[model samples]
Target: MNRFILSVSFSLALGLASALLPLSSAEAAGPRCLTDCTPRVGIVSAFGAEADILLAETTGRREHRIHGRRFTTGQLRGNRVVIVLSGVSMVNASMVTQQLLDHFRVERLVMSGIAGGIDRADHVGDVTVPDRWAMPMEVYWHAGAGLPSPCGVAGDLACLGLRLAVGEDGRPLPPFVPDGTDVPAGSWHLRQNHVLSRRTAPQGAFFFDYPVDAEMLAVAQGIEPPLQRCGPRATRADGSIDEALCVRQVPRLRVGGRGVSGTAFLANARYRDYLHHVLQARSFEMETAALAHVALANDVPYIAFRSLSDLAGGESFDAEAGALFTSGLAEANEAAVTLSFLEAWRRRPRR
Candidate 1:
């Protein structure tokens, strides 16, 4: 028997393989496995809507299930590609990315999805291809505000919050002193990720920001995608388009800016403003940064297209954000950009 083949009883007796899901009797026979998982490009999305357009365009698709996630390999615009939905949130995204990398011989990765708009420059329905991505929630939240409020209110003291978890000299944060700890209400310092390094930053150094492959970014930036300023709303009785939801400015395909992601859904207007001003973040979403992190660590070239679905923090936490995100304009726009990039890249000279 081939070493690649496994019997479920034998595998369980030995123990589960690292980072791999439990295998069923069907998978043990190797029938469900793809004979060849190789593909030139691996396209990923957070959910089905984001990938609906690309999936429709893909040809000769063959699907294989791993850990219950579907990975479909096919020819996209005449280029070899594998596309999968990463589900949603940071952990799910990371797991799916690693699985795709491990199972498929993917040379490059492209992410297409909808994101909340943080910067005023990015209007609703605009497709943003940020040069870099980061996780803004990597912070040390304090028990309470350390600085006294100038306005003398508990919430007002947040205005006086400490902006840095690290010292001015660049040393790591000391143990929590609690009562005298200098931090804001949430202490959203947008602190450094003192783990893996990027570019010049050495390992174990502060590296919150992760830059996508330069060549991929250039190819992405060079193309113009058909973007929509208005999207249809299901709430309308006659199924007519909603004018208020339409972007005030002509929807643009913007390149070069910071994008931030988090595990939580961000909907507070004040927090959105802070992310834009403090981190200069243009796009906000749940999964892209985590996906980018895994790709960068693996040394695989990667890029993402995030369509702005709504003004961040514009919707009430439970109500509007969810509805706005499902609008087809943002989903279709990002998918369009991803398809365009793939076509352009297919014709480009070999690296």
Candidate 2:
């Protein structure tokens, strides 16, 4: 009798262990019943610092994990929401966004983060909710002297407005080939920059501008969230206040313009000016455009708010001579704007 009872107990324990294991591929892929069926607004950020403010304020939060990534479901500004970090680059953004969509009942998507400001006139700490986003780095890097110059008379149907990629000093950059490649296939020069104002032939019907959801954009437009323009004020050991990292002007919110993204961390001023002039790009970052792409494919209404952390071409950390790298308020300011937008959205009259 004791032996039989022990065998039954072992079987029950084994079944319990199996139930707690991660779902198998086929099971996870199906539209199976999730433990939580709550419809939530998805808030995506590229990294921890950007998501930290929102995460801190989230109430009634519950957490879940998939393949080690955390997806937190919670209430923010009186709305049901799910928030996750999409990691850092364009590829990371694409992967995590697809995962989030597949696993959650996400009704709408909202993204906010710090970004490189393309125009010098646009100071750090200011927030911008771009009307459209694009992956400007997708391009055919022309073979040096072989491809027809789009600005020249030989420019034809294949030209696709090809322009010489320029440097920070506004000089045309010399093209170079990648280290490992078969020479017989023809040498190809890599252009870190590209002109994406139009589509390349046979890459049929690709978009240079993916417009954000019009309705969500309209909601953001009416929101006038106050933003921080300086670093966190802290007390010294003697209780004296330490200086805050202050930018040139009071941070303000601008609602429309194009925001461009690519794998590159932008530092080239000449390229920055070109994008601002050619594409009307106001912000540069690594993730938002990719997130926009994912949201569009999933038929989800999406919007992103980016706060300028630095002048893209001008102020890197060491290049702080002119105080251009005012490493403050960008994350907090964007988060503030996003939370305010959420509040406004919750209060918006239902259809």
Candidate 3:
């Protein structure tokens, strides 16, 4: 009887141990599930300061839970920041945005990144916080307008008469481009000095090419307080950089270094019009629109923060894309901006 009693006691102890082990493993594995939890904020970017910050931090795949859902399934900035890199085009932006929403369930989102200053008065490196973001209300495009159409064109065409119109109700109506717009036939050269002088063949059927910088705004709505500007391109074709890309100049205007030219256009009339209609932010970037679209659709608040790498209108910072060299201008400034952004979010007044 004693032996039988001891055996029973040992077996019960073993079972308890097994149950505790499984529970421990589960607890150690991933983020805790929280219902009606903390509000989450999102950060997005394409290139420049914000891009650098993301590249510096994230390992690509991560997950965290915030707010009522798991908005930040993968967190890079402690408990708050959920970072995403939206590849350079509108489609990429839109696709990733949806994925972020489904996975993280973000609440407030901020769209940020470097944008070409179309406003001549606006130099480079200046930041813009827009009250509104305009998007294509109509799905229409035109060719032969001497401007680069989204479906066609290589070089940076002028923003002659493209308009991003909204309805009286204040939502996007549709995206339309004036007739006779000359779309880039292929990928053209975009330099660092704010010069957009290349032309290329048409690639995608959807023509999204229209000036999205500062100048377009003045032409379209005549809003005062011209956009701010910043430094020029810093990365080289080989992805390496010399001292030329450094932000030696105050309120750096030209693209970094004497050798590389800036690829993006300055605030041309066309760019401003498109940005005002599509994005309508203080500044423009390659990634913001897509992030905004997704977050807004899901009723999530998103934010984007970027460091200025180049000025709006100037020479190419590097000779080619993906240049091997790094722009000193971009490297130095990005860190501070990123940190500040994080702290600011924590302090920002939440709705």
Candidate 4:
């Protein structure tokens, strides 16, 4: 009887051990659920300084790395946030934005950065929240009449526009004359989605002009001091501030205007005028339009806060003002507006 009782006790102990071993294995394997419980807001910046400012204020932070990019997940002013730097370009911005959306539970996207001032009314340190963003770089090239002459009218044409259409052989192609007989040679046209100024296009194409979320825009509007009057001064190597580059005029926020984005860093007066007059853009940057496009494609709500770092080509031929002074001020103003918007968003009831 004693031997039988001992045998039964040993079997029971073995069964208990088997049950506990599975639990230990499951715990060691990590959580089965990878999804975040809380919805996250995505904040993107193109520059290091801009990311630094936002990340510095975040709390309960955790770092993530995917495809060589670092995404910082944290809470800013009671709101869950995911912040990342979109390297300065349309492709870079679009790729990282898609990654963030796929990896996290991001409900909305916000971009805060500095841009070249396209409108004369806007100045350095002034923040702009545009209703929409346009891309002007995507264009169709029309072949020139022929090889441009070195002087006179041909030279002028080449200098102004024809040079952009020249082939690698250093010769201009024949003008595009579409005829029923045959398609014109050297005539280039982009598919609808790649073109800019979709509003002007005859047919719907994936053209430019991505609108910001109206509700998000309203949130930005409600923030106090949306505009700034003055910009911060630049510090010299000796730690002295450069007064010449300082903007004494108080900067103010301008809401509900058009913003343009392109890969080129524009610093030409003619191009700047074209953006302001033709495109009706108040601000021009490198990343916002790309970000907007990605967000829109994913059906995610989005907004941008852009501060004027310098007049695209208005301040100086070499863009001295932006390089020497306004960048810091623009960065600071953008960060301020972004933080204010996040705080207000946290307080607002969910839709």
Candidate 5:
């Protein structure tokens, strides 16, 4: 047996191995697994819509289970392949990755999802297999202000209730632009690609928020955990990560228009240090780091597959972002097809 083959006792686990046994490039490509317990392969994504489509088409399933619910798990080529939606935020992502590992006992974890591109050279729809990623958690603060006055309050000030803003330097900036004034949309602090590159900054950065998948070697040694959270901290009203702020922040990174581009000029302590530490960091995602954690802990031969959903640099989720997301999915499907066929072909019983 290949060193990677896993032993599973779950009904779904059984189904997955059985379906995969007659593995061959051609056979694997034909259909996917039918049950959850039998799934030898595991895929994790943050986007539920993308996960649902991929699972159903690849595994050919109309219904499935997750967290003991009738929540659907899809298929691939008539074989059972478990698909999970880890939600949008990194915390949610970490939680989901841990949950899947516990429930599935998957032999291998394949993290397929979208990520932002960081360099101008990387246009919309470009695909990147990031050697690793950086993950960051939010540290929030609150501001004090007077309560709002009702409509009829004679002395009420219209701006009293407004939330004040601060910059990274921890100094306040003028609350809002003058009513009739306009400022140029100046050049965003864009930089060249430098993640894991030699020129990355060295200090003041927090420890790796997200680990690089390629560094599976480090994960097995117990020197690190599987999940690595990266990216900017959430800056919400009162300077805390409230529900609305949390939602806005998570999606912002996924679609990729903000954040420092390239490793050329990282200002975020966490980001600069991440680049310095994990020279292998290439792409960014919410789930793969968590997936890496579980796989390493379980001794599974794991591989994280990500299709670029947007350029990591810039500042907004635009039409280009949409193109990248769609294109990345297509590429991931193709790569999955290729991998399944190769594994199946190798597993076929010989005469």
Candidate 6:
């Protein structure tokens, strides 16, 4: 009887030990457990209106909630796809994209949305597929000295070799300089093989311009979807078209230019000109750069299709332009191009 009891106890102990063992890396990755082995392309948008259009087009979708965000997995244009919203800004975009990468077998990443037009040549409803994306809002806050005198002024106090700018209020304006530059006011400060100190260490600095996947850009360039020219006119509450708000020209597709992202909703023409001249950016939005940065870090191919919803405050700003007219047209154009790209990818021969 005692021998039987000992044998049972030993068996129980062994079972417990086996249960305590950690899972292997392959087992830990949830995708391995899924029955489907097909790799999925990730589709990200900033908000519901954009995502809704894609979701409607996707078939056989199964919804899954992770980290409080809804991800729909299915086929779009016959390509395996997983669609999710990246929220609205840089932080939200980066976080959701990383989460998607962590939980899914995302083969590639693509974003489709609306952006403020920065290029004078591009009109509202035009879809732009930029070759690169950059964050223009990343800056160093150089607290300028209160007085105009250079002495004791924050502008004169060079921290990390950047001079602060004076504000209109007679106080120091935080010097808003691009990341990874050592140039003082007018002259460039050249340093050869300089070691970085703790204070001079690179903070919030990135390559600034992150290029889209070359092959993906080529595929996008090849897509020739028919685009909408004029957005529907804004209507009064009674549903009559407001002729004053209608955009007259047919919107066209522009491929291979630069896109920029920032936290601000730019409305000033002067700042728009600065972005156009300095960065050569065609469109400005709030999310694409962050998504590009995340994708680049992961070595994942990334691309974005952005339709112009507004002029970023140019030529008599119409605050109601997006909601009243351009939003639907932009979303439709983006979806059309994205679907076409998927078809192109399907037909391309695999290496």
- Estimate the Cα RMSD of every predicted model relative to the unseen true structure: 10.3, 10.7, 15.6, 13.1, 20.2, 9.1
Q: Each candidate's TM vs. the true structure?
A: 0.72, 0.72, 0.47, 0.69, 0.44, 0.71
- Give the CA lDDT, 0 to 100, for residue 287 in model 1: 92
Model 1 misplaced regions, further than 4 Å: 1-37, 143-186, 194-206, 231-248, 316-327
In the range 1-351, model 4's lDDT, one tens digit per residue, is 999999999999999999999988975543222435357899998867868988999999999888788999999988899999998888898898888877787888999887888888876677899999877665444464343344465523434332322323644322333343334543322112333222434432344478899999998888975444434446677877676556666677788989988887876666677667655789888899889877766667899988777788654443444433453665666778889999999998787
Task: Please provide, for model 1 over 1-351, each residue's C-alpha lDDT reduced to its tens digit, 9 standing for 90 to 100.
Answer: 665465756677566553254566544432221345555698999758868778889999888888777888899977899999988789989898888887887788898888888887666667889998988787655554452234565223234432333444554333223232333334443455544424423533345677988998888878987766555453377767665555555678899998999977876777777777666789889998888888866667889888777777886442333444555556766777888888999887786
Clashing pairs in 2: none
Off by over 4 Å in 3: 1-39, 48-78, 136-243, 248-282, 306-325, 331-335, 348-351
The residue pairs in collision within model 6 are 144-172, 145-154, 229-250, 229-251
What is the lDDT of every predicted structure here? 0.72, 0.72, 0.41, 0.72, 0.40, 0.71
Q: What would the TM-score be for candidate 6 when compared with the true structure? A: 0.71
Candidate 3's displacement at residue 166, Å, is 4.5
Overall local distance difference test of candidate 6: 0.71
Candidate 2: minimum summed lDDT over ten consecutive residues — where? 189-198
Q: How many pairs of residues collide in model 6?
A: 4
Q: For candidate 2, write residues 190-301 as lDDT tens digits.
A: 2322222112323323345678989899999999897754545333458664344456577889889989898888777766776787566899999998888777656677
Residue 290 lDDT in model 6?
84
How well does candidate 1 score on lDDT at residue 268?
72
Candidate 3: worst-modelled 10 consecutive residues by lDDT: 189-198
**Tens digits of lDDT, candidate 3, 1-351:** 999999999999999999999888865442232332344555555554445655456444344443232222234544355666555666766776665555553565655555554434333443443333433322224343333344344322334333323345743333334323434432221111111111221221122222222322222222122221222355456866444444333442221110111223343455445434443323444555455444444545443434343333334453311121243334334433544455444444455
Task: State the weakest 10-residue window (summed lDDT) of model 4.
Answer: 189-198
